[model samples]
Target: MPEASPWDGISVPAHTDYTVRQVPGPTAVPCFWGRDRSGACLFILDLDGDHTDQYRKNTTTINGIDVDLRGEAGRQRLVLTLEEQIDRDLFGGLCSTLIAALGNASDAPTSLAVALAHIRRWKTFLSGRAAHHLTPEQVRGLFAELVFLEEMLDRGGTAPAAVQAWLGPEMSHQDFIFGNTAVEIKSLSGTERSTVRISSEDQLESLNDNLFLRVYRLSDLPDAAGARSLNDQVVRIQARLAAPEQIESFDRKLVLHRYAPLPEYDAPLLVVSAVRTFRVAGDNFPRLARSGLPEGVARVAYDIRIEALAPFECDNDLVFGGGNG
Candidate 1:
C-alpha cells in the first residue's frame, strides 16, 4: 500500500488489532478475525493531548485495502497496515468451527496453499482436523450418484422409488433394476474447508428410497495408504445383477445399496456451504490442485472456505490452541 498523508495517520484507523513497533515507527499489524461482536476499534481524537474528536465504534469493511483517510496529502501522508479480512466462510458444525483461525488468503484459516504446503499437516487436518476427501477418479464413479440426486432435488428432492418387494404371490410395483456400490475415499492433501464428496448417502436418501450409498472419507493420513490404513476393512462389492437362467430377483425395483468408505476425518466439509449450495457447483477442493475431482465426478455442488480454522477464533487466545501450530 502507498504511504498515507499526514492528516491520514491522525484520523485513520490502522485496522490492526496488534501492531509491531520499529525504529522508525510501527511495522506490522494484525487483521480482522470476524468474530469480534464487541465491534471494530473506536477512534477518540485528542486535540492538545486532551479530549478532541471521537468516531463511532463498529466493524468496518475488511478488504485489506486502502485506508479511509479523508484525502489529506503532503506531510499529512501516513502508512500503516490494518488486519486484513479473515476467511470465516466455512458453513458446517454449527458456525462454531469457523469462528477460529483469523487471517487472509495468504495465511491462516488453512488456505489452499497452506493445505498443499504440508502433505503431513494436510493429512492431519483431513484425518482428525476435518472430514472426508474425494479423489478425482472416485468422483467420476459417483456421477450417477450426484446426477440422480440433482434430478431429484430439481423435482422436489424426493420421490417414492416404489421398488418394493414382491407384494402378493405374483405382483409388484415398479420393476426398476439398478446397481449400487458404496465407496469411501481418504485424502491427506485436499483443500481445508472444501467439502469433498461426489454424493453422500444422506443426500441420496433425501432423494429416493430402498437404496443407500454410504461414503466415508478418511483424512487421518497424508497418503492414500495412510487413509486405507485407518480403516483397512476392504470390502469390495461389485454390481451383481446380470444373472440369467431363472435368477431370484430381489425387489420390484432393485433398491441398489452401495457404499464408499472415503477418507475419514473430523467433519465433512463439503464443497458447498450455507445459503449457496446450488450457486456454485463442480468447483474444486480449496487447497490441493488436483487434475480434477476424478473426471466426470459430476459435482452437484460445493462450498469452499478460504479460512482453515473456524470463524472469529484467530485473534482469540487459543488460535493455535496451546501454541505450536
Candidate 2:
C-alpha cells in the first residue's frame, strides 16, 4: 500500500475560512495543515510574533498557489493555499517536504527563510512543467550541460567545486565558469543542421577572460544498446558525489533549472555522437558582441554555422583545462 499523506482526514469546517490541524512533526515552529472553505489544501505556519515587516515586503505571486500573511500581531500566520487546478498529490509532497525543512530550523525567522526558499523552488518546478514533463528541447539542452559537468568532474576537481561552476541554471552569461575561464554549452540533434544558436550578445563576449563554446551532437535513439536518458545521467553524477552538501547543492540547482525526475525523462534515450569545442576570442570569430550592438539593441539572439567556426576551433583540453590553459 502507498504511504499515508499528512492531508489525510483533514476537512474544512462550514462557515469558517479554514479547518486546520497542527502538522504532526517535530518542527521548530508551529505548523498546521488544513482545507479552505472550498476544500482547497492549505499549509499555515503560526508565527510567534509579528514577522510582517520581514516577510510582507518579499511577497510575490506563485503559480497554482497563493501565499499570504493572515491575522494580526501575535496571531499572524503565514499561509500557503493550493489552487484548485494544482494536483493534490504534488501539493501534499510539497507540504511534507517543507515541514521536514522547517524541522531543521531553530527559530521562527529561520523557519520563514526555509519556507520561502522551498516555495521558490516549487515555483520554478511548476512553471516549467508541461504535462508534468520537460519538453524535448529542454531535455536535450539539459543533457548537454550534464555531459559537460560530468567531464569537469572526471578531470579530478572536487565534486563541490565542479558542481558549483555550473552557472547555466542561474541564467549566467556563461554556462560554466572556472577562475578566469568561461565555457558555454550547446546541444543539437545529430540529424539536424550543423549550427548552434547563441541566445544573447554577451554569450560569446569573453571580456578580459578566456571563453569557449562546447557543442554536443546527440542522437535520440531509444533502442540503441548504448543509449541513456536524462535521468540516467543525473543518477550517474549523483553516484560520484559522496558529500551530502555537494549532493544537496547539485539537487537544488537541478530544481532551479526546472527539472524534476519523472518517468518521461527515462526514455527517448540520447547518446552524444560528437563534441566540438571552439575558442571564442580573436576578431576572426563569428559572433555578435554587446559592445558592437546598437545602443538600444539588447537580448539579441543569432545562429552561428559550425563550419564557419572552423578557424576558431580548438581542442577540448584548452577549454576544460581547469582554467590553467
Candidate 3:
C-alpha cells in the first residue's frame, strides 16, 4: 500500500481564508500544510526577517501554482498555493519531497535557502517545459553530464561547488562553466557513429573565453557485471556527497532536469566505451556560430564529424585540470 501523504485528512474551514495543519516532523523550520476557503492546497513556511527579502524577490507565478510571501515582519510566511489545474497527487508528492528536503537542513537559514532553490526547481517541473519522463536521448545526455560531474567530484573539490558548476540542466548554452572556461558534453551510442550534434549555435562559440567539447561513446551492456543504469548512477553520486546540503542541492538539480527514479529507468544498463575531448577553439574548428549566421536565422543545430575534430583534439586534463576523465 502507498504511504499516507502529509496532506492526508487535512481540511480547511469554509469561512476562513485558510485552515492549516503543522507539518509533523523534526524540521529545522516550522512548516504547515493547509487548504484555502476554496479548497485549494497550500504549503507554508514560517520565516524570519533575515531572509524575508530573499523570499519576496523570488516570489512569482509558477504556472499551476502561486508563490508569495505573506504577513509582515515577525510573522512572515512563504506560501505555495496549488492551482486547480495541477494534479493533487503530484502536489502532494511535491509537498512531501519539499518537507524531506527541509528536514535535512541544519538551521532556519539553510532551510529557507533550500526551500527557495527547490521552489525554483518545482517551477520548472510544473511549467510543462520539461518532459515528465526522460527520453532515450535525454537519458544518454544526462548520463554523460553526470559522468563528467562524477569526474569533477572525484578530483577532490567541494561537492556543492562542482554540482553548482553544472548548468546544463538549467538550459545554459554550455554544459559546465567555471569562470571563463566552458565545457559542452555529448554522448554517442556505438563505435561506428562518427558525428556529434551541436544543439545550438551558441554551444561552441567562444567569446573571449575557453570552450571544450567532451563526447562519451556509450555501449549498452545490460548483462554486464559492473554496468549501471541511470538510477544506479544517481544513487552512486548521492553516496559520494558528504553533507546533507550537498545531497539536497544535487537532488534538486536532478529534479530540475526532469529525472525521477521510476522502475523504467533501471533497465538497459550502460558503460562508457570511450571518451574523446576536443578544444572548441582556433579558426579551423568546425562549428556554426550565431555571429556567423544570417539575419533572423536562429535555433540552429548541426552535426560535426568526429574525424574532422582531430586537429582540435586535446587531453581531458586541459578541460578539467588533472582529473581522471
Compute each candidate's TM-score over C-alphas: 0.17, 0.63, 0.64
Deviating ranges (above 4 Å) for candidate 1: 1-133, 158-325
TM-score of 2: 0.63
Query: When superposed on Cα atoms, how far off is each prediction in RMSD?
Result: 24.7, 7.4, 5.9
Write the residue-wise lDDT of candidate 2 on 44-134 in tens digits: 9987878787676445567888999888787678899999768778888778767765655666766776677567666766776523667
Flag regions of model 2 displaced more than 4 Å. Answer: 1-132, 322-325
| Candidate 1 backbone overlaps, count | 67
Clashing pairs in 3: none
Q: Best to worst by lDDT, what's the order?
A: 2, 3, 1
Tens digit per residue, CA lDDT, model 3, 104-222 = 56665667666776666666656665547788888888888998998988877568888889988788889898867899999998754789999898999866377889999888888
Cα lDDT for residue 20, model 2?
90
Instruction: Report how far off residue 296 is in candidate 3 (Å).
Output: 12
In lDDT terms, how accurate is model 2?
Answer: 0.80
lDDT scores in order: 0.23, 0.80, 0.78
